[model samples]
Target chain A: MVCIRFLKALQSVLDSRITVLYETHKGLGARFVDFAGWRMPVLYSGVVEEHMAVREACGIFDVSHMGEIEVSGPGAEAAVQYIASNDIERIVDGQCQYTLVCNDTGGVIDDTIVYRRSADNFLFCTNAINTDSVFCWLLEKLHGREGVEVIDRSGEYAQIAIQGPASLDIFKIAFGIDTEEIRPFRFIETTVAGSLAIVSKTGYTGEQGLEIYLAPASAPAAWDALMAAGAGHGIKPIGLGARDTLRLEMGYPLYGYEITEEFGPIEAGLKRFVALEKGGFIGQKAMVERAEGAPKSVLVGLRMEGSGVPRTGYELFSGDKAAGNVTSGTHSPALKYGVAMAYVAPEFKEPGTRLNMQIRKRSVECTVVAIPFYRREKK
Target chain B: MEFPEDLKYSKEHEWVRLEGDTAVIGITDYAQDSLGDVVYVELPAEGDAVTRGETFGVVESVKAVSDLYSPVSGSVVEMNDAVVDGPEAINEDPYTEAWMLKIELDNIEELEELLSADEYQQFIEEEK
Candidate 1:
């Protein structure tokens, strides 16, 4: 009876999930919040300050909450190509492709990055909340199929992303590896902080950066090493609050917000990722049919002309007619103005087209603008 | 979080400073600290009627939005334009510089219902 009561007390105390770097975050003065059933840091110094740090200098993020799934065997290539919307064959070893996992109805299951490891090995980095569903979907789809195995490796690795213009220098100082030759969407497998890790030249922020995946046990040491090395370059510990703002400034689609099971990739303006000509893939037929028909709503970027921030689910209007609604919206720290991504009628999709966004009870004027609201200039 | 002795606090985390018939209102330091880096603020215009315990405006942080409730019901005499232009000031000094509105008090007795500095501190402790 004592043991059972103690176990129940322990279970109650450990209700919420936490990542491997939760202690590290708490030590850095992170503000904790309940995110997708996980106790994650929402901010440290501040959202705007950390956001500017990533844009101007360097910032590190704990992305261990992101899910990782491995598919390996002789049939891995065939299975991946059938499920993913992107052409997995296009990426060689050491290359990653931004792709979408779709259901049979052509709705997005999760937007993911597929890394080609070898001829029969591939890894998928999925959204944190959709990890289990994605893993189950992959298993159910590939059930009874020979020679392919799906394994969830989410708990095996801790992911860290270092972003900004100064990330390359910090990475070199910390890892002693030259990443100048590694192009975007490419990764290299090597030892980082005495542990095998995969360093990829990819990030959600529209800045030059690298995402490192390594063993969870080695993450704290690796994070400390990077922080020490990056101290000279002004690297701030970024939190998920700044992460959302950074990605929002780039008009990147968040899983639950911009891409959902109700909307298809074509309507979400991700038709390029869907390989329509390459038939036999799941959702290809429905996606192709969607591509042919006139879309009911199209996702477009909105720049606020009036005061007030546009929030998700806010109704949008073209003159007096109800057009659509906002999916993801934020006050852009980089632009110093409110910006949003909304799904609107096709007629109101053109840049400079005027629209009214209902923020609370007030109707705020906004204009349709081209996406990628803030793009870093290349040297 | 610093709660001023002269200012009365509401259960909704708003502070009110009674100046004769005028009541200056703003979010408390505890409220601003909890909100974290306020990005935008929406305030009712001057001459707008406000009711006690009702949402008079909104304060938006990077990740969340919080409603600012009225401590005492009255007519808005003035709304702070400086705070509206730069919402981050709330995080810097929520009490003085970020005062949201000055209202002509409808009932001075309403201030009696608010918590004192010591009471507000105890309330926040219990809240935590």
Candidate 2:
């Protein structure tokens, strides 16, 4: 491995105005890109290669850019439930629930993963750019409350995700922790790499994997230990590039791309995660109205029939009519065909409906297909 | 990184080779290296008029789409259909095998604006 101190100095000299990775992703031959005001690695090896590594064997990702917020104290339970779109009461201790923070109009503020550590303590994993804003929002929500505390612990933690079919076994090998007991959405606070970490069995990709949230100071040791343990396991370091493709293939909604301030969970096909029955939350009325009324547009998957790549902001046309716009699209590295998720008219949201993706001045034909272009085979 | 000494270069990192009054144009090695995995290439058809320093085509990589500028003001004489058919040619051999277009020069004086191999090397260095 490359030296961390040397790279830290080199990166500072190179770009002085960006978030530096304390776990040392810079020295690992990662190609850094300016992502959401931070110099984050977009790729270490080729995206397709690293992607295949995750799908076939094992791959590790430095997802330290994801923000974390701590909400713990008296009445934290009710406060978290009020702030989140999902039913946080459903999860027991050491369980995570995928959720969304919504605007008053039911538009999604941000999609987040809320981990319930205890009845009075909940931790939210927010999107990197949305951390400060969400923290401020949480603070604003606790105005009438006396004991609830919202602390932005985004910078204090480093999140390393080891994802693949072999990720569980590899986790056990690397950290001497058996995660077989940690079923889907379940997590365990364990000693890993000689540091306390929360190993969660959750992933963006539709694979059995672990997301280890550890202290920033102990991240390098954990990363090194994982790498050393995974050396014989065909482990590759994945980057944000592969991360995009993997999540996209799984039909996962990225915050800005799919779930944004422009749309709500019902329109984004996250109805299961949104708990309207639980009630007593922001955007609850708007969500109820949306559920009772006809939505303007709904998210759907598209499979390209022709050759051109369908990218974000690409217009969708139904015959000669303007259908909608592509939110997140990519040439799916797994399928070897172009795949995309877009919001379209109600008529075009049905499967087998033909549409076109406007690339440059030309249109590439596509068809509305089911979401999640890839799913791992159950053993 | 390989900037052939024989071929001339433009400020936009396009290489030019003089074939009598005609100029063969393609992006330089540095250009392709930066683009990374050219997935799709869109080029103007033959007989299309292209002005100097204007977009003649677009090269789409896995990352982003970049406009390809013409090195000289001319009418397109020939098109390299290979790049449109298989875009990876641009990444594999951007100089010879992936020539974007051949233009019938409107004015040979435009060649004076082009840079030599040494000057282009310095230009790229300053850019870095």
Candidate 3:
């Protein structure tokens, strides 16, 4: 309900432009689906084909859809630390940390990335739907904190992700920078194709890639620059369909689908983001207590023992009892098997523990498996 | 999108290629395209009875799974093992090799209630 209210408020304030791919999507026979209220490309050639392309070579994505916020002035780090689950103090400048913003009750507001640009400046990268919520939350948190400024810069920046093994080479030529020096979770404010861009060595695809954040008007130019530089490397433009599969293959959680407000960060297998030792965050005490106790359910990976593929919202069973339900599942092109992530009863979370997933009304056999069903070879 | 002129079509995008009392059932190219990607297909076992307009199987995509309904009352004579093993065949070539099952019909008259290629195309256009 907060998201709905926030979206209504945002509509009154922001004017978002749909990208050119919206038209190109229809041309490529893409089944356009509404994602976070934007008409997005779900599939182009196909999800499976696009998913395989990212695993094999390079798959470009118009992630311009993700929300961007800039926090400047002194006390920006404290403002983020007081609101986010991860310890902001631990993160060094030019580095990014995956963190969760939580409600007072320990429920997830959203999972976000905090990019520490400097002691006084920071950028919070978040999901498209939760931009308003994150902005409001930070604005309220920093109300009396002098010298701190929270600005919703979502309308200004466009995000593009070139994901796969060939991404580093693609970044090197497009930006004329030695991208090999950039480590994971690190970023550099550099010019690419004559446009100011923040190139970050981070992605959800479990591949070596850079997510370029630049001006919205310059996005098409940046995309063209990448495609031109990467044409020889077998890079192809990918849609959201491939992005989901690639992330699912790596066991990366997607907001609204895998993680939701009804669940806390610890239960969602994101305990790493919960800074229990840190003092006085919105959900700190509740999360700390939960960490010491047992979770009602723990997220685990499941594979169908037979042939059928498990899907989101499909019930997971232990004997005749409804133990859990699937959150994300896919037919991994690399594994050549059906893989899924589900929050089952704690007893069922052990690796190799046998379980059942209701495909239709039938109880199909399954087993808990290790996550990242397909891990690409390290670069 | 291929909608065979000789076949009977359902609003749900199923197609029935009839030859006397026998019928070959599969999803149409329109169905495959709408489904986005065919990751898995669950078909009824041979000898299983299917009622007209009842769900006979399911086709799963990365985003969603849709129930496949039978257009005619029939007994499953043979399930397409190839489509089961390689569900992507329906995405690659939906019209021919991706047929779901071969059925022995109980009521051939049910085919009369379904749409032809032109009618199905019109039905799809109206749906959009």
Candidate 4:
């Protein structure tokens, strides 16, 4: 009886409302477009200038729109293990792990960050659009369990991602927290601008940086503190324009655009998260049956040999026959070439496999490359 | 922002300079700004016949790659080698040194039908 009511409440929350992050810049001349119900910043200045800022110097990204959730109580770890594809048994306090929450059919519900705050408490940082759906899914799963508590902390918190090579120094000076001791995927709770913040050594840009989480009311102060400290070091408050290109360069998948419900985690090259060894979880039986082999349209990186760019929805052809379509593409600022990720027939997923993109109905020759068209230099 | 009075413009943000039987063609400043960071250009082969309002090639930027349409019916006589080699010239200077192609105008009357510099500026403003 309680499970049924809990499921109803969870469904109501999912259907309630969509939150948007609007930046009123006083008509600085930006072409605003609606993305996943959020009016995100595509480009404030220019895509190239902003892209260069992150690669060369540093850039501050307003990532407050990302969803934040908290799980606590005795059954927190059990609930998380059942909900997530990766085993959470090894997660220690003050560390984070990137994993996915999948549907029963092994389809991705959302890719998120699991931050274990303590033995019985953790946080799930999810993509903005998947907030309500993920929360509902977690609740629905937890409704059948006993002594599990899940809270939607998204409204209470705001996140700012300071990314790029210069991020560590800027973060250290801004928050007066020594970042040298903080390793990748580790976090430390500290005060920034007289407000409590949890600084995590993690970012989507594949650089040395910290994602500072603070109270929603303290956002303005936190933003100001970081900008002021990073002003001399060439840290600019970048928009979603550079953020997409930076992640694209690193070949990170964006939900709905790259990874979708129609494509399972195995086809998307994310089988590392699904642990068959773990006793049981949602999607376990189906994943186990398909583990032997499943004919999949595999995801791969596409690079143009000629003077053209392969964009999303552009048909990928293997000698006049349609094989797949591009999921994401951009002129990589670091490589200075057009790069894209796409799903193609498994037979043609190997590197150096020649393919063609239908640009304006004409096939432009391209080659399949390994994932992550660009990688950060080892320090 | 500098739209020379002698040039004729298209609503798609292409500019043409009528030179008797031939017209030089390129994109306007507004087009470059909207596209942002011209990285590569695909120009049609010389002597390829093209019609007005038909896509001839593509111009790639960091954000998107859009089709470049022909503003006048003609055969492609020559393409700007400078802009092809260094595409940033299109964003740096779209009018003089960054002209895209030279077309032997099939009908000179097509130029008279295009928007004048003043009209083009007004069209851009209306778009905004």
Candidate 5:
């Protein structure tokens, strides 16, 4: 028994990948968690503290685990338009669009961001766990096609996100670049911290921020430079724990949780991102059928009225009937209450609808609320 | 992690301190540290009965949920409302201010099953 346990532990250690900033995170007193086969920092100071820093000040995240794929050649735009649910044609060069990739039956493969660098060059940022699968799916779909090339560029770059109200100022200070012209969803290829990087005005957290894609070897120096420049802006290193809560506060659908292969984008309340009018995509037919028919279930946000935090897989109830189940839930550090994203019967999707979540032996009351639970006021 | 020498420990990481016929129970420092930044806590009512080695409540952190096991069987006499209102107290001071419940002992003999402070320290070390 001991030998088996030892071997298992050894195997896990060998299998888990560490980011380039692993040593830096360790030095800053980070508590690590195994996320998608990567040993990532779950927290440095605390989840709540890091969460607040992003809301009020600034926070930097080592998101190097997120995968990057590049599609280039004359047929790049065609290849992307065929696979992505959103209309890539809508985004011009230097802009990006939040989109989804789906299978033949219209089930979501992954929620991704498609960046149009030029007419012949595009990039995809995919979820860490789904990176390899997404890469293969893109390759298989574009195989035998002329003038299109798909490459898995995930290992070549490390991604970092600096977010908050003060992000622009920090960016100017750290990289010596005037980001005043960089609108949301737009990016610029420039040198930062003595390395070539793609600085995109995008982030999962609903805050003003930039996600920088730079070479893996230059990540440590860039992280240090950002932190140093953000010192006066009250910047802190954020971890995955706060990252989940921050995105949850925005009511964003995480790939595995809200958007999954079993549920399409329509059921996940992301129909707007699916450009059904743009025909000939992989899942257009099924998605159009789903949009016209009554949905099996619809995603809604639940705010706890009573005590006890709702957790993933907990069943929701309306009266005595089982409504649905919680997909992702957490105590909102910003809201000071428990909030959750749940899939319930279509009849129970109204914002003010009341429901009960079965948490252990007790039923905790919650109210269906409009998502974007904590939206930032427009500056 | 500080393990009070006067208190007995359970294998599930609960600590018990006897005061006359009433026993005060809380999680140990090691347990609270393991559960970082507790966000919510649910405990039994004042009159509820708890059995030894059974879960009496739950402690939730941002990323995980953990059950609180009773080290000794008893009828709950009182619950620390402060800890319930602000669960971060458990992370701040698990031993004194975060004492979860005070219960009237159902079987004083259950204390014999618990470990000494030194034994618990050794146990956690071996667990790691």
Candidate 6:
């Protein structure tokens, strides 16, 4: 009896609200890790190999762990505009915008993509771990408001991202998408694998890519059709590990790593996403004050002059004085050197400023450079 | 996946080959496989001392960082500059070409504590 109970408990511990791609990962030499309570594949072959595959050709990502919240009602527009940092009024029907949900103190609560389904309906694509908190925050804020309805639809849907240089062609061949018409940051609903799905033109890679949102039950068929369609197109399945490096190479901010509750958009080099003139948003005044340009520190990119890959929380120095610390870093496969994104003092954020990072207790010289160490070519 | 018959292995996945007063050390194939593609490796300079079960160096993949521990106490006599410069070689041939260092042993008796090839294989099996 005790052994049976132990086995049952062990089964629960192992099973983590598995994604639709869970079975597919097992056949692909995937190594799994527990991330935010989800058993996520950290890699298939290796981080560098997968990184290069996406850079040279194309890559597919199972971003099903991301959450969704559907908001619709008479007062939905006012509620959304009051909640997010970006001006949702700017996004019309069939469009999406990357924005931040900030606290009253101008700190980032969560970063999300707002998909405008219609004038009064929007779906929020939230980070996996922050889904519950964002939903709760929304409910609490919209308590007295009568006309707006916010529903947490995170568990109902799954998401996928196809990224790289060859993404558009692969998407066209696989899904019959007419890429010549779809503008960036726009989305359209269509049938994929005999199921309803929302195909969007926004991506995190700084490359032209598309995001697909569909129901969980039909996600398997959709993924299978996609894999079969793109099998001969040099499309490799990417994992969270490579996804991290690819985004870091572009200096895109990861929520917990670069922008958190302790820092504002201005400090994380995302001021453009914040619409200061559009008042009535949460943290509007504090964001306006920050826009005055008196932030204590700013995000900057650092390339190691010496060897040694910098990791998160490593100390950074400018000459003899203590500077800042690395937030996210890796040995960039494309750049052929270690690249890091750090929040350093304003004086040390210049393009050519030389700094030092202590890797494994040894100080190594690094030079501050611009974000996006890699840029995709325009077609 | 290959564990040589003559080399002694540690639970931390380091393999050591004893030759007279000198000992050669590197990560086992199991270790290299688990670490994935190694992007960077940090090694102690020549003439530095290392103690048994202590961290002597670090190997970093694009995702994670792992400490390379010394299985036997010794003073480092030489370092593999090749693996330091291009760490992917360790993934290619962890036992031979990827050998991390050659140390002059301070206490050769420490070899008795290490597992034999068969025992190490069993240990890896048990871990799995």
DockQ values of all predictions: 0.69, 0.35, 0.73, 0.67, 0.70, 0.82
Quantify all predictions' global Cα lDDT against the true fold: 0.92, 0.86, 0.83, 0.82, 0.92, 0.88
Question: Against the true chain A, what TM-score does chain A of candidate 5 give?
Answer: 0.96
lDDT by residue (tens digit), candidate 6, A2-101:
4644554466477766788798888887888877658889999788888887888888899998989988998998999999999998889999999999
Count of steric clashes across candidates, in order: 0, 0, 0, 0, 0, 0
The lDDT ranking, best first, is 5, 1, 6, 2, 3, 4
Q: Distance from true position, residue A320, model 6, in Å?
A: 2.4
Model 1: number of backbone collisions: 0
Top candidate on DockQ is 6
Indicate which candidate wins on lDDT: 5
Clashes of 5: 0
List, residue by residue over A256-368, the lDDT tens digit for candidate 5. Answer: 89988989899998999999998599989999999999999999999999987878899999999999999999999989889999999999999999999999989999999
Candidate 4 lDDT, tens digit per residue, A1-379? 3565466456545553222223332233445545554555678788878777888778887787788989999888888888887888867899998888888887788999999998889899999878877888888888867878989998887788888888888877887778878999999888876678888999988777889888877777777777788999988777777888899988889998778877767777778877778967887777766676755688999988876767889888887677898998987888887899999988889999999888775678889999889887776
lDDT tens per residue, model 3, A115-154: 9999999899999878878888887767888888988888
- Candidate 4 DockQ score? 0.67
Error of 4 at A248 (Å): 1.7
Candidate 6, DockQ score (0 to 1): 0.82
lDDT of 1 by residue, A1-379 (tens): 3464455446535786788899999999999887766788999998999999999999999999898999999999999999899999898999999999999988999999999999899999999877877888898899888999999999899999999999999999998999989999999999998889999999999999999999999999999999999999999999989999999999999988888997878999999998888748888888988899998999999999998887899999887999899998888988988999999999999999999998888899999999999988777
* Global CA lDDT computed for model 3: 0.83
Worst 10 residues of 4 chain A by lDDT: A17-26
Candidate 3 is scored at a TM of 0.93
Of the pair 2 and 6, which is ahead by lDDT?
Answer: 6
Q: For model 1, name the residue pairs that clash.
A: none
Q: Provide TM-scores for the models.
A: 0.95, 0.91, 0.93, 0.91, 0.94, 0.95
What value does the lDDT take at residue A163 in candidate 5? 95
- Score chain B of each candidate by TM-score: 0.98, 0.97, 0.96, 0.97, 0.98, 0.97
